[model samples]
Target chain A: MKLRVRHVSRYVFDAPVKRLAQSHRLWPAETQGQSVIQWSVETENAVTGSGFRDGAGDWTQTVTVKGPVSEFTVTAEGLVETSDTSGVLRGHRERVPASAYLTGTRITGLTAELRMAAEAALEGMDAASPLDRAHALARYVSDHVVFAPNRTEPATTAAEALEGGEGVCQDHTHVLIALAHAADIPARYVTGYMLSTEDSQGAEASHAWAELHVHGLGWVGFDAANRCCPNEYYIRLGSGYDASDAAPIRGIVDGATQETLDVSVAVTDSARQSQSQRQQ
Target chain B: MAQADQNFFNEMLNGTDVRAAYENLDRWQANMPSDLRSLKQHEAEQLFRRVGITFAVYGEGGDPERLIPFDMFPRVFTADEWRKLERGIKQRAAALNAFLADVYDGREIIRAGKIPEHIVTRNEAFEKAMVGIRPPMNIWSHIVGIDLVRTGRDQFYVLEDNCRTPSGVSYMLQNREIMMRMFPQLFVENRIAPVDGYASALWRTLASVAPKKCEGEPNIVILTPGQFNSAYYEHSFLADLMGVELVEGQDLFVEGDFCWMKTTEGPQKVDVIYRRIDDAFLDPLCFRPDSMLGIPGLMNVYRSGGVTICSAPGAGVADDKAIYTFVPEMVRFYLGEAPILENVPTYQCAKTDDCKYVLENLEELVVKEVHGSGGYGMLVGPKADKAMIELFRDKIRARPQNYIAQPTLALSTVPTFVEEGIAPRHVDLRPYCLVGEKIELVPGGLTRVALNEGSLVVNSSQGGGVKDTWVLAE
Candidate 1:
């Protein structure tokens, strides 16, 4: 499946910033599951520098706009061809040891609720394999946390999300990651783009999922909010221990008192869109 | 007034005979009158205060403004002894660098089953972002400060290793400077290896590890956390000695491809950074977002070979206490040689059997936190009361993996100037080994003397004082 994605973020500083710098992990991953056709990430009045692939196999670049700038727009548009690999992240280059992902971040830290959920998910299936257990945990999170938007904040912990019982893809991913860790499995958060199928509610501009490191399969993706493992329709970007580390864009501005953010994401199935255009 | 404890090895004497290395020092002390010795001690203190060398070492922060006492007596070592120590220290330093390079890359030591995987991979000091970065010269720790305590005439044990921004090299230099100023005749009478070459050697070592793309005389700077830091004096002192810029986080900014230092002339591109800040505060974009004390995109520049960071991020993993136990193993695995320096027998409280042994013999062992540094969160069993020991026991039990216990070895003593008279006080050695294109160390080190009588901990925060270390010419 070929996917077209356009992600643009606008930032308006209330006061003029002395300097602006941002680190972007917006490039699609080069793996067996995906191939990049064309991609360009650009921001007006910014110089992109120090671009390199990180230890987690994410291509990151630094964007610097030195000035008393009040506003700017960062736009990333890409066409990527992906394959259905049964959610298995194969042939992905990463140097970070699997054990390192077992480390929990502030938002993905294991809480008692996550532990109990993991235990309950695998209660009768004591002999279930690690892959099966991961699936069961993902299912448990999907069934428990109903897909609800604007119900939780970005800084909400997995424990809080579990208690709320209503959150979007980010909360579902955090809770699943926490549960995976409670079961002594290594897992990380992945940030990417998802095509909004008609039936899939709340498929927004961007999507997040949890990736569990299984013994034989390496990393396997599970999107609990969508209640299925990610397939060709998912465009993998990068992964980190939690949302902040895996964020597509992280910025630091010098002496900007207040800033406003505007984000837009449009992901479409290229073949279907082309067919509709032909019909038109 | 001084009791010559026969149980502890006295460096100045060997069974009632003056040691060969200290014979001249003993005669020098004999020739000086008591009042003059006292006056000279006062002068040394005044010199130290005038020089503004009052800050503490590492994270052992007491009163940052208080001056650490300068002992009039010096610790002496013979050429043969220092030669062996140099070899051992260099070997350990090489292995530690090799371990770090491997831990971030192939991890052959872990694959060979020499060290456990979790101990290295799951360590809090291990930076996942640094896993694949190939640093200049493949050296993570440019300056490896190995804490050593001498037990016997030929026996030395490494207490711990400091890989990141090891402090007190300034103390070593200042002590010698003052000692020479006070007693020029002593320098004339006894031939001591000059330690002034340390600044030059350090400069060369740092310059040698500049990024490959850096052309000509690579510009370098010392990145300090600012004036409020406990080790700020050392940062400025090194920068002055090296004739480089002493900069704070704000003084440097990342531009296109390179990090630049703001100067009166213009923006000077930095090729190497001897950063005295912690890794968590080195780059705000890559690390803690709340940290305002770091360059926003310095790590990215480092990753792309625009600049170099001395004692690279994640270098602390090699010096961790739990990882310290495997130094000898690393020596064997990486260098393919026998370890010249022996490690103290340590017991991990995380191991049930070791924990039981440690619990059963609380009074004879020293318990230290695995992650704690600078004399913090440690229990000197012999020095602790019952209540203190009980407190440590519960701490260990609550988090066994967080603690490690070792036998309290009898640290050797040197004749130190005391209120009553010269007395034997426990001392330790921290020799800074430089690694770059080559591995090297100055003959002398910073000798920390426990000023409190009978105390074994040599941290400055805990009644520890400074002494000039001398290596005699053959």
Candidate 2:
């Protein structure tokens, strides 16, 4: 599947801000699961610093807008060709040891409840492989954490989300990551774009998922919200310990003034769009 | 200074015959009357106060600002001993930098099975963000402070290494300044190597590691945590000495690809930042989200090669206590040289055999937290009461990986002017080795002394004092 993605984030300040600086991890990842055909990240009147690939195999750069400015918009426009690798992430270049991801972050820590759930998920599968255990944990999270938007806050932990029984994709990802940790599997939070709903491929598509580092299979994607592993429709961006670290555009405005944000992300299947255009 | 234990070796004496380095010092000590010595001590205190080198004496239960008692008697070292020490310290500093460079990039040592995989990768100080981002000259720790303790005339063991921004270099300079002011004739009589070159060497080191984007003379600034910090005096003093800007987190801002300091003249581009701030508080956008002490986009500038951070962010990984054991191996593997200095035999409590040994011999060993510093959260087995030892034992049993134990060495003592004339006190050395395009080691270093009788710990925060450490010029 060839996916065309456009993500725009606009900021409006009540008063002029002194400056705005943002670190962006907005480029599509280089992996066997997806390959970028074309991509460019831009903001009007902002100087983009030289981009460098990080330890996690993500190319990141800094964008600065010298201020006395009222507003600005950061837009990420890209086209990616993705394939179904049965959720296995191959050809991803990274220097960070798999053990680095074993440590839990503030929002993805394993709790007593998470531990109990993890144990229950693989009760009789004592001899099961790490990949199988990871799958079971994702299934368990899908069953327990109901996908409900606005049910949990940004700072909500996996344990808190699990007990509350209502959360978004982020909560589900965090819960699954916590379970994977309890089962002694390395896992990370993945941020990306997902083209959902086949017939109408163009939809609001900013999404998140979890990747478990199995013993032999390396990193395998597991999306508890979708109740399935990531497929050709998924375009992975970057990964981190949790949601905040993996945020595509982390920005700060220097001023005492209050600011507001407006974001829109649309991902469309290119083949369907071209066919519809030909038919019209 | 403490009353010397019979078992502890006294550096000034060799069976009643004064050591060659102390021959002149012995005459000076014997001639001074008790009243005059106290008067000179009083005068020294006034001198220290006037210079504003006073410390808060953390956990020592004193006034907010109190003097770190200055001993009138100076610690002396011969030219031969200092030469050997300089070589050892320089070798260790080079090896440490090599280890850091390798750990962040190839990690050859771990793959060789010399150091366990988990030890480097699992360390909290080991940062993934630093990987593949090479700083200027491929150096991580520009300034290395290695702590050394002596047990006998020829036996010196490294207690630990401080690869991060280590304090107490100011104390070394101040002690010499005050000593010279009080007793000018003593200095005239003995030829001592000058340590004033340290400031210039440090300045050169900082300049040499300037980012590739820097042209002409690189602009340098010392990034301090601000006035309330314990080492604020040292920061300002270093900046003043080196003739550079002393800046707080808010004093600088990132614009475009560079970091600029807001000066009275206007914005100035900073090529090198000798930051005294910790890694977690250096940049808010990169690490901790709630850190107000960090500039929001400073790390972005650092990462993009717009500026350089001295003793780079993840340099602390090489200085960790657990990592200290493998430094000898690093020296052999990287430098292809044998270790000149010895490491204190340490037992990792995480290993079952070591843990059992440490637990069985809790009375004779000193147990310390792996990440703990500043003389806090440590059990001085010999000095500790029965209750504290039991508490540590239980804590170690609960989490063995958090602790490391070493048998207490009878550290060497130097004669210090006490209420009842000169007495022996345990002392340690911390020499600041500067590495950049060139590695420079000043002859003299900070020598801390334990003020209480029979105490082994010599941390200033624990009521220890300092003395002028003199290395004789040949």
Q: Which stretches of candidate 2 lie over 4 Å from their true place?
A: A198-205, A274-280, B1-5, B56-64, B348-363, B367-405
Measured on C-alpha atoms, candidate 1 has an lDDT of: 0.90
lDDT of 2 at A168: 83
lDDT tens digits by residue: candidate 2, A106-184: 8988788889999999899889888888889999988998887677988999999999998888898999989988988
lDDT of 2: 0.87
Winning candidate number (DockQ): 1
Candidate 1 lDDT over B404-441, as tens digits, reads: 88888999999998876678899999999999888989
RMSD of each: 3.4, 3.7
**The 10-residue segment with the lowest total lDDT in model 2 chain B:** B55-64
lDDT leader = 1
Considering every candidate listed, which one attains the maximal TM-score? 1
Ten-residue region with minimum lDDT total, candidate 1 chain B: B1-10
Fnat per candidate, as a fraction, reads: 0.73, 0.64
